[model samples]
Target chain A: MSRFSFNQITAKPWTLPEMVAGCVAAGVDQVALWREPVAEYGLDRAAALVRDAGLRVTTLCRSGFFQLPGWFDDNRRAIDEAAALRAPVLVLVSGGLPEGSRDLAGAREHVADAIGRLVPDAAAAGVTLAVEPLHPMYAADRCVISTWDQALAIAERHPAEHVGVTVDTYHLWWDDTVLEKIARAGDRIAIYQLADWITPLPAGVLTGRGLPGDGCIDMRAFHDAVDKAGYRGPIEVEVMNADLWERPGRDVLAATMTSFERSFRGR
Target chain B: MSRFSFNQITAKPWTLPEMVAGCVAAGVDQVALWREPVAEYGLDRAAALVRDAGLRVTTLCRSGFFQLPGWFDDNRRAIDEAAALRAPVLVLVSGGLPEGSRDLAGAREHVADAIGRLVPDAAAAGVTLAVEPLHPMYAADRCVISTWDQALAIAERHPAEHVGVTVDTYHLWWDDTVLEKIARAGDRIAIYQLADWITPLPAGVLTGRGLPGDGCIDMRAFHDAVDKAGYRGPIEVEVMNADLWERPGRDVLAATMTSFERSFRGR
Candidate 1:
């Protein structure tokens, strides 16, 4: 069965337990969880609780803020954290444009180099690093990887056995060549993320993504294409709506899962 | 000399004569006058006045709309108009997804095929066709040529001694690879358009464009980069602001030219 995991921002401020509970409530069987919640609650306890609640840890929410002076050490530490939780896929946000630096390609290269170095450690731990391409608007200030093409260019350089890309509709629905790119991506596409492209009120990334059905994107087609791509990975729901963020976390998670199923999986 | 051109929307509904006078008085040297303005005040007469005012027609507003049937005939008429008016470039707003079409790339191919055949005719008539990429938000309903790379691909396949691209900042300022793309584009760049990106507005495109100096894009860096790329073309000022659209024509023209100089090259 195909399943989706809300990355929490599809329902903001909701803890891992709450997201797990809500995903179960809304018929989602998997989740992509962030490290903060796991750390705060203790991984062993959280893992035990997740198993008891009957949810799969589809991916561990992240690693790769690769621009700091000590990013290598920090990134390695994150890989270690993913190992401790036994997460199947480690989701990476990649990080922002560094202070006073406008070198986007250079930052991307740093990420590739970091990932190359981390691959051995990741592969040994049986974890795959999922490179999530953010929206192009964040190309300068946030993640330098803004397209699956850009991400794959780097991933292709490394071993696909441990390194691959994530396809998020919110980040990619606008790409005129999205379907072709998705089909072309083939087996290297390790994750398929779901979120609708709501025009940001302020037109930036920290806010503005909507739930699956609230915006203009044809979510049904998007889901169908992902399904046809032959990769049965987690369809993680990740929205960064500021309005949804302030609402009761439970409402955010439950409502998102409901929309996700209706819009994403409904034929 | 870094001369600016008015993108007729700044003087909406005004007589071409009045708008031309306003732009010249504001020290602008050329115009990208719209088809409506030309139609309102007969094309021949409008051309005669713009020529008499010592202003060049940087580009005839638009000539591409492949999704709509009969577009070939309509676009041919536009090309004829461009030739008669001595417009250096004929802007092509490639039409969007046809009514029931889910395939953006297919729509793009249809557009390219339409333009490919038209390029010979455009070249024979001494007019260059310049593809103007609209922002990605308009991808589903407007032009599918949403990225420079995409536009460049079309330009490459359908090269006219007269076929090229119009680099509109409003449409592409967010892409991280723009600097490299523009640098590589060089002389193939026919128009370098300037507009500002605004935020904190509604959940749509209305009222989203700021005056050049009032927004966050590094306009000077862009101008300087294009210049360095050997594009000795006019920097066209095009604003799609709802507030400015509703203002008195003369004030809008003056405000636009002022904003252009402040945010771009006039020191």
Candidate 2:
């Protein structure tokens, strides 16, 4: 229970203030924030609100579409926002191949280079750039970094504090070898997140994630691996489902917490 | 284009006779047939129709749902069907985990054991059992064999003449290490298939494939790898697109042939 954190995206419609208050009321000590709502509610005010309520910001949701124009400036601003919000990590979902492009190898090379370029800014702002490997299904339209090995390959080139990898069960549970590799990742594991893989993926294949225990993933394996890595950080339940989004934020948080408890029970 | 084979699933709505006639009309010499429609049209009759037309059956579409009850008998029947059609290879899509179970490793072991149990029948019938590794997205509900390594690992334990792996571009393009491994696979490469990966996958994700030139797969890379592996066999175009299925069988075959020609044009 001490490690549980509710990622704001789990309740997609919840504003920063409302998410903070809901987490506080639910007795969750930490919350992970997304950039859009934080900017919508004003970064400083949102930071102050969470701080005043005695909640720790686990991570900033994301900021890495490196394939797009203005990626450098946008990512630099994201680093600044992360620093201002007192979040230790900024998740990076490397964008897919450029439009009309079939060069996945080239896109991946560009991601490695782009992350190399962002390291100084992140280090200066004191925020870890967590490279997240989205599922291979998303390799075409979302993120080309689609495996634990790929994420670690890029992050190993930088200092551990400046660049790291994210461990999200939803994006990685299909992999047979990821658990053992993740167990040895140590400090390179920037943030740990949980989302179960459910069937009948939606059209876009983005928001069909299940709560921790609602699907077939063996969450205890992930928990054991992260523990073996000596990670003592927030375990954020970051599911994104249309049905979950329609519910009230408090209800979603409560459900997420219950799911987390269920997943971690008897451990 | 002597090596080109048009898989029947590319024209989903075409009947067994209509598909055979259409393939003959398109000047196609070889085809890969699925078990469902072949059974519907009477396997023996369907075999005679294609055999009389002098069309060689490249491979049988499938036969490996090891998780189901009666999988052994069903697979034996599939092997008989392949023998009747004179198809050299029987593609195996190892079924997903059982109901309410999350033991992926156990499921994979069951598939290997099930295949081992069927190897004698396959060898006696002169049908090569080609284990197919589906895209990892289908790992939960369709096939547990989700990577080149996993497929190859199981196949290596059996005689190369009796068991091998199916390399489909759509299922494997995202893998960085597969090309080199496939290049070294030698005679263990049983069937080579092509289908491009397109964006915005449809619901269920079973019928969202693209024609060779319609999406992002590099057909030439696959060609080169298989060539280096000393494979000189039929290259079946096995795309399952909803829009393509809506078209007439003749039109679909023409378009698939054109895509195949374009993909292999300069190579």
Candidate 3:
């Protein structure tokens, strides 16, 4: 319970203030936030709201979409937002191939180059850029970084504090080599996120993740790997399911907590 | 055109006789057949129908689903069927995690062991078992083997003549390390398939694959790798799309040929 963090996206419809209040009421002292809602509620106000409620911001949801136009300025703004919110990490989902292009190698190299260019800003802003390797299914339209080795290679190019990898079970459980590599990652694992892989994925394949323990992923195996790596940071249960989103915020938070608890049971 | 082998699933509605006649009409001399349809058309008749049409069966579509109850006997039957059809290769899609189980490592080990046990039968039948590593998107419910390395590792254990790997561009394209590894695979490349990766994957994620040049996969790059490995065998264009299945058999084959030609245009 001490290491648990409620990521705001788990309850997509919750207002920032409502989420803050809900967290405080639920005795959850940590949260992970997204940029859209923060901007909607006003950044400073949202920051102040969480701070006044005595909640820690574990991570700023995302920043990197390097394939888009104006990504440089947009990422810098995201860095500033993370700093303002006192979040220690900003997640990077390296964008997929440019429209009508089949240059996956080029797109991946660009992600590394793009991250190198942003390391200085990240270092100065006191936020670690966590490069997340999304599931390979998303490689065509969402994130081109689709393997742990690929993400770690890019992160190894920079200082650990400025750039590290996000270890999300949902995106990585299929790889036979990943668990062993993750066990050796140590500080390169900036943030550990949990989302189970569910079958019959819906159209677009984006919002079909299962809550931890609801799907076939061996949560204990992942815990063993991360624990072996000496990571004792916030464990975020960040799931995105259309059905979960339709429920009330408090109910969703309760369900998330239940799933999180079930994942770590007997540990 | 001499290297082209049209996979029968590309035209799901075509009866075996209709497909055979259509292939002859189009000057197609090769095909890849599935067991269910061959069984439906009566295996001996289907075999003779294609053989009489002067068509070569490149591969018998599939055999391995090791997680099922009667996999051993079923796969044996599949090997015999492949032998009867004179298809030199039999592709294997190692089944996913067993019902309600999360031991992916254990499941993978079972697949390797099962294949090892079947190698003698495969050797006797003069059929090469082609282990296909499906896209990771299918890892949960379709095939636990989800990378070229895993497939190659398993194939390397047995004599290359008895066991080999299936290289499908759609499945292996997301892998950064695969092309170079495949270039060194040589005779382990039993079958080379082409299916492009398209976005907005429909429900189930099974039938959403694109025709060779209809999506983002760089088919020429695959050709370069396999060519470097000294492979001059048949190239099967195996696409599974709901919309494609709705089209007439001749139209689908024509479109597949056009896409296949376009993919190799600049090469």
- Residue B5 lDDT in candidate 3: 97
Candidate 1 vs candidate 3: the TM-score winner is: 3
Q: Find the 10 residues in a row with the least total lDDT in model 3 chain A.
A: A197-206
TM-score of each: 0.77, 0.99, 0.99
Tell me candidate 1's fraction of native contacts, as a decimal between 0 and 1: 0.25
lDDT of 2 at A239: 95
Clashing pairs for predicted structure model 2, backbone only: none
All models, RMSD in angstroms: 4.9, 0.9, 0.8
Chain A accuracy of model 2 expressed as TM-score:
0.99
Please give, as one word, the docking class of candidate 1: acceptable
On a 0 to 1 TM-score scale, where does candidate 1 land against the true structure? Answer: 0.77
lDDT of 1 by residue, A1-267 (tens): 366676754565777777777777767777767777888888788878778888777778777788777877776767777776666778777876676564556788888888888888888888888898877656555577887777888789877769888888878887866776677666788887777755434444467777877776777777677767777777777777888888987777777767867784548
lDDT over C-alpha atoms for residue B72 of model 2: 99
| Per-residue accuracy of model 3 over A1-267 as CA lDDT, tens digit each | 899999999999999999999999999999999999999999999999999999999999998989998899999999999999999999999998999999999999999999999999999999999999999988988899999999999999998999999999999999999999999998999999999988889988888999999999999999999999988899999999999999999999999999999998878
- Order the candidates by DockQ, highest first — what do you get? 3, 2, 1
Q: What's the i-RMS of each model?
A: 4.4, 0.7, 0.6
Which residue runs does candidate 3 get wrong by more than 4 Å?
Answer: none
What lDDT score goes with residue A139 in model 1?
58
